[model samples]
Target: MTDAITPHPFAFPDAALEDLRDRLSRTRWPDRETVDDWSQGAPLARMQGLIDYWRDAYDWHAAEARLNALDPSTTRIDGLDIHFLHLRSPEPDAVPLVLTHGWPGSVFEFMQAAPLLADPRAHGGDPRDAFHVVIPSLPGFGLTEKPTETGWTPERTAHAWVELMRRLGYDRFVAQGGDWGYAITNELGGIGAPAVQAVHFNMFPVFETMEAVDAQEERALKRLRDFKENESGYQIEQTQSPQTIGYGLNDSPVGLAAWFYEKYEQWTDHGGDPESLLSRDEMLDNITLYWLTATATSSARIYWQSMANWQEREIEVPVGFTLFPRDIHETSERWVKERYPTLVHYNEAPKGGHFAAWEQPESFTEEVRASFRHTRQPL
Candidate 1:
């Protein structure tokens, strides 16, 4: 862990806002392309429409206010400033649940789920499902500043989360994650940290240790392999040359928008039209976070920091996995149990993708709640 203390509130600086407007006004937009589809890139017309809305219509302050309304806080743990949203349930004795966001995502990903998790009744769920929720921005993403030193791997991230729970006076909590969040939460349990009572994941990576290559995993693995072979160029690029790409992304707003928007369409379960599944405003809000924070480069640091280190370790916690149809590939229960000796639950979703929080919060919440039912302490 970096010897840095926790972070403070991330106020939207006026200077940053002024700079955004200036950039928008002076944007040297690309020439009108003749094509209609996104083959070449963001369709020229759609890009223009979004840019106009972003520059003229969207309210950054309103978004900031919504963020502020969530009861966020910052505290230093193990030398890093950690910014997190802390929503305590009205249920008085709610279970603590730590939710983490993955790369290309920020705490904002939980905008809808935070309140819902904190007060399930408000969302038409049982009060038993209400939870004391903690959603933190990974160090160096969004409001959390990037680590200036080393040892910021996923394992270290788990440590930070443990310390965070400790500071809040919680002895045990349920843990949930997707994408990189899944990796860190797994580490929390794998390390046998008493702070984490159980773990739940929407996105999980399966290795060979799980049951003998079952038919489903064999097929999922084949598809995974194919997906990587054909479309994993971004990982290679991010790991090796993030700064190079960051330069181009940082120089042009549209470049940054296109870079992320492409992934939203390709990696998500949006059928054909992305808007069918996700709101355009939502997509832009996320992209705007990256664009304004200039987090494109720092966010990639996670890839370079942990991608290699994690393949060397295994998570030993009692794990539960819920596979979504739109995910890159599905993991067979046999495979997961093989890799994770303590595996306890396996689930499947009708529809959703890597962005499960945004796409299916109800199912995601219930799955998390169900996975953690075994972890409750005896009164």
Candidate 2:
């Protein structure tokens, strides 16, 4: 058997990428609007600048080559073809950590931190903290199987990932995630998987009810409501009418980039310009993943499957939760403690945005490692 059964490392062919560059160069741009602010979505002017750079300067081959240099390999667990970066530390006792990414994110999230985690001495960290990292492209998200059937919710994804780690010979390992990762990591531990010693997450959902509201929770509730009303239009579109909006995203490369540009622009603590935080090259690499795999529509299916008559799951695993300020309004500590009684460690990060894994990898990794240092492995 050939590796063709599963997506191999840096599977993107050069010819297809060249086609994308050519298409981007020939973008049928819309009429220039005389606007200084982005009251609408992606500003035509800014995106044009990015597009120009993307076409003229940004090299997909170079970016893809750098990604290829990371050494991606494939494995099988429970009849699913799992694509992952299985970077091992030099130390024999290195703790294996399984990382999962969310929608609009890929295994690329760990690209920067791979070397450091596998060899901390080179990065100024103690070797004692060295780790063997396994970053997987979730089924239907990245290079993993984009199942044509339904039932790939957070819970199911977590279950499959747990099996993935166990199959890798990690009888006891740590699990960490952000975004949809937060939801799934909770479930990963909740299922009482004996292999998963501890779970860490950057985006945790503290249960909320119409009945409970203190002064602080009340204010956060107001902010959440305000954010939803003003800034969550994209999510509403994604959650409700993904199929309808899929045409624009799937049809044109520019349209697809613009849609994602809006997210990077708004979600990031970008100081104003999306390009400031994410350069044209960095952003497009992620977009290119969707483009090459044609997984954009399939990725949206997670929202439809989960939120469409979706019910929440109960988490009973020992958890390490880090609540970022900009992350969906802070759940009252009282609420978190009450809801997640099994939570062993909780930290409130003063700085970070939704893309915690990318925005603050050092902080995110340190917190996750420290939180699970005393991982309570079950017999």
Candidate 3:
């Protein structure tokens, strides 16, 4: 039997785009937050600014053309249709790398970086650094189908990625990710799948046990505490009651925009405004993907499914991490080594944040290239 994967082009109809604008134009009003600062949540004025642009100025057709240019396709794995962008490099010896995106992130995050990784020579990098990049939208996230029932955890996703790569005729390859993609990649290596030769992550997981608290570690620890105290309300709501919030997010375009824009503000390296780092178009492109796909509830279910799998596992394969300065939960080298014993490469990027690949595609490509350069020659 053949591994018959289907080619599914990303084509959203004109009516859908019109409907999105209609919803944005008719957004219900919310009173201004009592405090001037963004203490409570997304400020009404800020969301209104975003909505104004989304309703009037944002161009979905241009974004759709870019997405379609990637030549996206789909394959059925474990009874669910998976959406991915597979770009083959000109270099014969190019490494096969599967890149994964997490929540509030779609394949759009890697759109700029994928071609850079695949054809580094064209982008003013060494020909030896080329990679055959495959970027998959997580099961419930983008063009992929949402699970009808439960059990779509990170472990399951890891297995699906392994199979997906194998179906693409890759016997052995490398993996890289951030956010939920981090957990899935770690789990992939931890499962001891011979197909996964080495893995890398921009967002590293920190085990609960602490070793020492140096100045850097102290700052990271404080940030972790701050996240749990102040920034975890969305996490709790999504993990606990995704369906409740999903209703509002599904019904209202502004509600969905506010929900994600808040993270883009807090998580990115930019000033208070997320628009400073990512253009209104870049952000809306992703937000609109979620809107058209109707994945608000489905995407949140991953948190609930993988809540228990948050702890570190013994990943036997070699691993690399490029820690961006502004990312949340900045684990120290020592902390990371404790969990990833076979850590072979680690670098601290001067710029970017949680969405490194999306924010700084060049920096992200350089780090990814460096990480796997040594691991390229067959295992």
Candidate 4:
């Protein structure tokens, strides 16, 4: 294993682009959905529109340039090469922050937010709101090396993150995440990670055990039940047979795009059109990363590795929750407090959804800033 943290510039090769284009062009599309809407999944016409844009308009070179501008790097941690973007703030007393990305998302989700968080002054914010940001692609995702062994659960990833920060010479830091990122950040809080001062989650992972449900809680429970019943087929397959499905996803570009695009549509708050929230290029950028990395199987293995039980776990450090209104379910403050007794901050944004930072970076940034302000250094 190499000890040096080498500077790594992202360059998607020409051959890969050609192969992707060829696959997209020669896509053997399926019959259109029986319904006219996205209830059955992403409609054939919608997917075709995406394919057209991806093939004719999307520019990988421009995306690569944007990525390259970030000063990304890779370092070996636990025998795996972890790729991360480290952006230092101009503020002399800027707090260190490590942001983790989850499934169906990558470090790219935070691309727009990175500069704002790192150098708020440049983006019309006070210097005191600055953070020295570190965005690491999780194991088996994006540029990070896929683990060969079977022990890369959220718990393990939390430990690896601590080491990653320690190696970067940060003895203290805060963590932020949503979706699977939220799970890992919660795990860090659970284990009392030595360097993690406090943690924030947009998608709070608190499950309520209610014997009596009120109107609001009833609605939330209904949404949870709906998710379990209708929207979790992908989870079942990924958790059960990730390698089997990986074959199709790794082999077919359209299949991969549709699979991810469907989630972006359903999971995001875009009035049934994900494109309304995130640009096609942004969506394809993430999907293309998953495709180019051939991480379909490796990334899905995380679900298989950590799908045992959804037992409640205690988080030790101060916790903050940014409640996005259109997220999967709405858990009340009472339910959240049950799990996070140290809950210091809670606010529900009028806009945004599951991918809060990506869809509404400004609101998400403010929530993060307010969430950790009390814990910031020089307090």
Say which candidate scores most in lDDT: 3
- How many clashing residue pairs appear in each of the predictions shown? 14, 0, 0, 0
lDDT of 3 at 198: 89
TM-scores for all predictions: 0.90, 0.90, 0.97, 0.96
lDDT of 1 by residue, 1-379 (tens): 4333343555778888778777877878788777777656667777777777777887777677777776667777777678888888898768888899997777877887788888988888888767898888898888776788767988888888988887887778888888889888878877664667778888767554444356776777776776677656777888777778778787777777777777777678898987787777788778777877788888887887777667524656577888887776578776666667777788888888888888777777777777766655521
Off by over 4 Å in 2: 1-7, 32-35, 76-79, 206-216, 376-379
lDDT of 3 by residue, 1-379 (tens): 3477888887889899899988877777988899997898988888888899998898888988888877688889998888888998998888899999998899999989999999988989999989999999998998998999898888889899988988998888999999999889888778765789889999975534565569988778777878888888888988888899899999998989999998898899996667889999999999999999999989988888886556656888888999998887787888778778889999999889899999999999999999998677732
Off by over 4 Å in 4: 206-208, 211-213, 310-312
Cα misplacement distance, residue 254 of candidate 1 (Å): 1.7
**In model 1, which regions exceed 4 Å deviation?**
1-10, 30-41, 207-215, 312-316
| Model 3 global lDDT (CA atoms, 0 to 1) | 0.87
lDDT of 4 at 219: 72
Q: What digit string (tens of lDDT, one per residue) describes model 4 on residues 144-183? A: 9999898887887888888888888787899999888888
Question: Which stretches of model 3 miss by more than 4 angstroms?
Answer: none
lDDT of each: 0.77, 0.73, 0.87, 0.86
Q: What is the lDDT of residue 352 in candidate 2?
A: 67
**Cα lDDT, model 4, residue 379:** 14
